[model samples]
Target: MFDITVLGCSGGTLEVGTSAYLVKSSRVAYQEILERELTDEIVAVDCGSGLAKLCEIVYDELCGEGDSMATKSLSFYTKDQVSCLEKFTSRGIKRVGMQLDTQCESTPMQVAWKLNHMVKNYLLTHPHLDHCSGLVINSPSFGAHSGKRVHGLDSTCKALGENVFNNVIWPDLTASDKGSCLQLCSMEDHVPKAINSTYTVTPFKVKHGELTSSESYASTSFVISHRVLKRSILMFGDLEADDPDTPNEGLNWKIWQHVAPMIVDGSLRTVMIECSTPNVDANQPLYGHLTPATLFQELLRLRDMVRSLNGSETLEGLEVLITHIKHENAMIPDPREVILGELTELKTLHNLEVNFTILLPGQTYTVS
Candidate 1:
């Protein structure tokens, strides 16, 4: 089973919290699948904001026995903020899939800095602030011996350099210590990179609105696989689908083709997608994101793709975790309820056996 921990899954700002997820492989020897021996290794997906709440959860798990006052200060976090980061001592986490930089309001950077010993690699989906701002704020700690490796597409790395790490807005972390500390690795699309002996990550391009000349935009969807665990998880960063009538609307459909075979074969265990807004509230043109309607359409297309590929195959037992839900807007009121209701209706109408999970801060689940 793969351990999936939801740190923060809210879209945009931290009204609810931003995107951060922790994934750990419960190591099962390939030869001992029947014997069920397990080892523990962890990798974080995204490190968005919401440090206080995340710390609260960890604190409860680690220091529940003691009075709250006694455990007030546990490293960088203070009494008012919250801290139980020491819980990570149970497992080793070396890599983060998307390197989300810390925000001013929270201490995500401090948390990362405190745990730099275990953090070695950061795989970035895009250079967007909500996704990568944490890395910028914690530059001092990442320099020198505590340096961390950052991996992303060439375009993504370029965007980060020109927009985020530029000295004007933020320090150029790459130039620090003569570039010895923070190692930036540029990745190519479709090429799988080994993240360790157990994990391999493959990046695929996805359509997320228009990229104008002035915009330094680059985003991707990722497929993370564990060879020994025989499990894979698909993660979609912020994205939008082309118009139905447009000839190029098949972006996700094509991706479904690449991923459907694994889902059908039961090798892909979890699929995490962002549902940023309600159908009526999504401004696809202004901000590239997914609404419930578009998301449902994509899921239907994926189902069809699987059926066409192999009629006997089904998505049964495959877990679909919806992440990055936008905070409740005045117009939408309760976005999560509305999205869940719509998804439930669609599932009932189509009789999909797949399990659905709505990711929230501090929630953890097992993906097998």
Candidate 2:
């Protein structure tokens, strides 16, 4: 089982909460959590929101702030699941039914710091500012002695090294020498790289859209699997539906084909993807993101692929955790609500049996 915490899930409009997820193995014992020995076991999928957001979450949980957004988002989890999450938060909060000292402030900061330290690796899908600003901002606090590694594709690593961490914008912390805190590692496509003893991620390249008329922007989707249980979850970065007019047209189809067998065999049932906007016009520019109509069409294609691989025609038991919805403005209705309504309509219209959930910051979800 995997415990995924939505540290942040906004596409670009929000400042504090914008596309970071902390993934931990549920196999770790409760005693280990109490002992605070989970260092190097936790991996963050992105770093758009990091230590500051984590601190905020810890403070809210400890002080009974009852942030309405968190409360509403967490309502999706059962009581038992929320109880398990309390144990995962801090040593002061034990298993279900234990009392926590809500008055203490230092304990919450300590817990937040410990949780931040547990993240030894970051598997980044791309280096967009909304996807990596937190990582860049929190580098100084990572401790020079800490051997933290940032993993990404060659283009992503190159972009970060040349543009973001070039000492002018931020400190040049991507060196491997003793003084540097971070080591930037480039990963190859389709190769499964072990992030920790418990988890391995296989990355597949996907086209994000055109950077220029001649150059296409690149993004990635990762299939993260538990080594022992063999269960996997597919997570995507910003992506658009394949357009025949683009240079990298049909690239998204490759990812669907690769994961169809895993879905059919029941080894993978959870997919965390992005739907950045509501239903837009056919000619509207997405700028490397998906609208509700485009997202549903891509999912329908996946369902067809699964049916061809196996005799099954339905995506039953599939959990689609939608991420990265852009908040355009207050003048318009909430994009999340609008997108959810459209997705529901599409699901009913096509009779696709998939469970869709909009990811929100400060929520914990367990996938088994």
Candidate 3:
């Protein structure tokens, strides 16, 4: 089982909520977490938003001291959706609440400070600012002394080393010397690397979009697995649909082929993917992102692949958590609602059996 906490999930247009997630094996007890006994265990999938959001969660939801900002954050969600969030969050609330009570002298910031230190490995998909700003901003607190490792593809690591952490936009923290805080580790495609004793992550390269007419931007999707249980969650970075006009158009198909067997074997059931916009004109520039219509098409491809493997065309038991909705304008309908409505219409139109949920920040989900 994996417990995933949404630190932030927006694609852009907001600073406080971007695309960060905290993932941990359910085996770690809350008491053990409070005691700070684990090492190299907590894994941060992305760090677009971090400590500040954690502080908000602790203060408003767990401590119940603030003006219910945490609850207000979910105002767009339906009551049933909010109830689901509460159900998932309730699993850890009691233990976390107990820990909060014991640390009465510690303000929310202090508690969040200590909690943030538990993350020893950061798995980055790309070097986009929205996906890594928190990692860059929060490096000073734990990186220098803790020896935290940032794992990503060679291209991703190289970009961070040369562009972001090269003493201009940020300090030179990518060195292995004692003064540096972060160590960049390059990962091989499709090879699983152990994050800790309990979890392993396999990276798959996908095409994000075009950087130039001849050059394409690359992002990644990760298969995070429980070593013993064999259960996995597939998490994707920003990506465009497989357009034949684009280079590497079929890369998403390769990912679908790779995971179809896992789905058939029942080792993978949850997929967290990005849908950056609602349905838009086909000619509109996506800038390497997905819309609900495009995302549904991709899901149909996966369903077809699963059918070819197991003669099962329906992804009935699968959970699809949509992430990274880019809020565009205040005059328009809320993008989340627009995307959700479109997805619902498509699902019903085609009788697709997947369960789709829009991810909200400050929520926790337990997937088994």
Candidate 4:
């Protein structure tokens, strides 16, 4: 079974945190369960802001030190005061900064520095700050000695290079203090990129169309498969299918067509998708995000595609674990309920045994 930890699974809102998931494919032996060591190779899908909260939770669980970092946020640091913060930092946490922006901040560079021993491979779905800002700060903080790799689409990489890492808003972590700890790698759509001997990651374009010329963003979903475990997890970064009312369109259908083949082959075991709002009315549909209703529609399309690929095979044991639900708003009803309720309705309508799970922050799930 592959284990996935919900680091920070909120939507675009910083107050609610953002996306950052840790996946581990390795399993401990039955006899060694008690003494199981943490996985050496940790794959991060998206490390956005609000990740400091997850860091704090993990810190409390592991070190029991709740007094030092009572305040969350990593923006308190100003590039020049690394030495001062390191004084109070834990062992191996080479540096520290003042508190960051609590709503849209990541775990301090020191925290990441302390855990830099683990091989981290970050995969970016897009260049949105809520999706990749944390990675930008933390990955390169290990300085000249670090070796973190970030994978993204060509356009996504270009966006990061021009906007985030061009020594403008932030220093290019890929080239700071001699060399960068983070190495940016560009990925091609629909091509299987091998992470190691056991794991492979395939990227597919999603329908997060551009908003403005400056904010020309594109999204790429991922399919992660482990050869040894024989399990695959499909992650939809952020999506919205073409609107019958708009002139812009064409990413979601193509992605569906590419993934439907895998579903028929039974290679895709679990789907970790995002549902941002309850319905289209509550969402800014032009921005390319999904609501519960849109997500349901997407699933219907998926069902039809899978059926077209392979006659009438029951999609039993398929897991649809949802992520990236927006935070509760005073203006609208709670989206979590609406999303789960919609999924329940779909299960009843289809009479399928597919499992639907809601990923909450700090929760751990095993998807096989």
Q: List model 4 lDDT by residue over 191-275, tens digit each.
A: 9998655668989877675677555357888888777766777887887765545412456666667767877787776788887
Candidate 2, poorest ten consecutive residues by summed lDDT: 90-99
lDDT, candidate 3, 242-294, per-residue tens: 87455234888888888889888888888989999988887898889999888
Clash count for candidate 4 is: 4
| Candidate 2 residue pairs that clash | none
Q: How high is each candidate's TM-score? A: 0.77, 0.87, 0.89, 0.76
Rank the models by lDDT, top first.
3, 2, 4, 1
The true-structure Cα RMSD of candidate 2 reads 6.1
lDDT of 1 at 199: 75
**Tens-place lDDT digits, model 2, residues 110-183:** 86776677778898999999899999999988888677888889999999999999989998887656477888
Over the stretch 79-104, how does candidate 1's per-residue lDDT look in tens digits?
A: 25543423221122221122222222
Over 4 Å off in model 3, which ranges?
65-70, 74-105, 244-249
Candidate-wise lDDT, in order = 0.62, 0.77, 0.78, 0.64
The deviation in Å at residue 137 for candidate 2 is 0.7
Candidate 3 clashes: the total is: 0
Decide which is better by TM-score, 3 or 4. Answer: 3
Clashing residue pairs, backbone N/CA/C < 3 A, model 4? 73-100, 74-100, 75-100, 76-99
Cα deviation of 189, candidate 3, in Å: 1.5
Best by TM-score: 3
After superposing all C-alphas onto the true structure, candidate 1 shows an RMSD in angstroms of 8.9
> After superposition, which runs of candidate 1 have C-alpha atoms over 4 Å from their true positions?
28-40, 50-54, 65-116, 179-181, 212-217, 246-249, 281-286, 328-332
